[model samples]
Target: MKRITTDELRAMAGREGLIIQGCGGDLTELVNGINDMLTQEGILQNGDAFKDVSVFEYDGCTNLLFSMENVDLNIGKLAMWRLQSHETFGGTWLSDYLPNRLGVDMDQPPAQKEKPDCALIGQDGNIFNLIGIASRTLKENGLGEQAKEMRERIIASGSYDKALCIIGEYVNITSAEDAQEQDCGFEMGQSY
Candidate 1:
């Protein structure tokens, strides 16, 4: 999770916040190597480069904290990109950040499906019971996968309103009276 991001650099906005970690070795050697790298990259030369950057032992590891005021952020980014590849440089588990961990293609739109009816009003308001009704409705409509997804999201939703909303996402919520009305087309109040 250790990555020097472009946005982070901007947020710092020319302040003191860059740090480079050293793998177990001579701390002095690690510091010298970094200077050599910056010089090789044509970013900065040795001697004066380490003036603002401090090397010290921290939590059983040597860390180089760079005071960002003296260092150009763009040049620092270039240096960081190069440093990330070093076997004994940066910190543990450094890699590019990804927003969606589910591997789902966020670009594609969800398929349009006609939501089936589920009677929730005046029915058992218990969350589990409501979930059962919603799941059954979806399954009856031949949407077994959506039913499963709804179950997972509803249970982990962490609140009643959230769970109800999840059920509503997959099915049409109806009152008990409306369900009965849909079952029969005759007018309930009629005089002949």
Candidate 2:
């Protein structure tokens, strides 16, 4: 993990060969997440000198490229996916990716005319899985080869899809509960 400035990221995009693309929300959040991870790892120094990270909109999402040298691609991918998921899930044409596994209609027709809330492009190639990162993190933190094996089991069991379904259910339940709470408050006020 290494904290890189916007200029450094751009230069890396130019030189090495890693690509990071995000659609919707603030790109600074993504940069900060990476920087924070790096900083936690003691790879980044404290100060404004390294805070120049930024992302430029390209195609539909903001794209930033960097080198993958000494970087864990799995963690990076998960971080991006989780962030975008938080931002765009439940929006039109931006439903959870996991529901697709359950034969749910997650994809919109090209002629439908609604833009997705978020889209991600990975230059390292499209084997997107946040679980992969979790597995890798486990291994990195001392689970060793067993961590890798468990990650494979998760992928095989379609944990990613199940995770998405669970997340959607949680969000729906939470929203409903919040609405009920608000209605209850309103009724109490009226009674008073």
Best TM-score goes to which candidate? 1
* Runs with alpha carbons beyond 4 Å of true place in candidate 1: 1-111, 190-192
RMSD of 2: 21.6
User: Candidate 2 — which pairs collide?
Assistant: none
lDDT of 2: 0.38
Poorest stretch of ten by lDDT in candidate 2: 112-121
Query: lDDT of each model, Cα atoms only?
Result: 0.59, 0.38
Q: Give per-model TM-scores.
A: 0.40, 0.23
The deviation in Å at residue 45 for candidate 2 is 5.1
Summarize candidate 2's per-residue lDDT along 96-141 as a digit string, tens digits: 2113212333343312212111111222222345444444444333
User: What digit string (tens of lDDT, one per residue) describes model 1 on residues 98-184?
Assistant: 112123333444345678888898988999999898888875554656888999988788999999888888998988888887788
Report each candidate's C-alpha RMSD, comma-separated, in the order given: 21.1, 21.6
Error of 2 at 58 (Å): 2.7
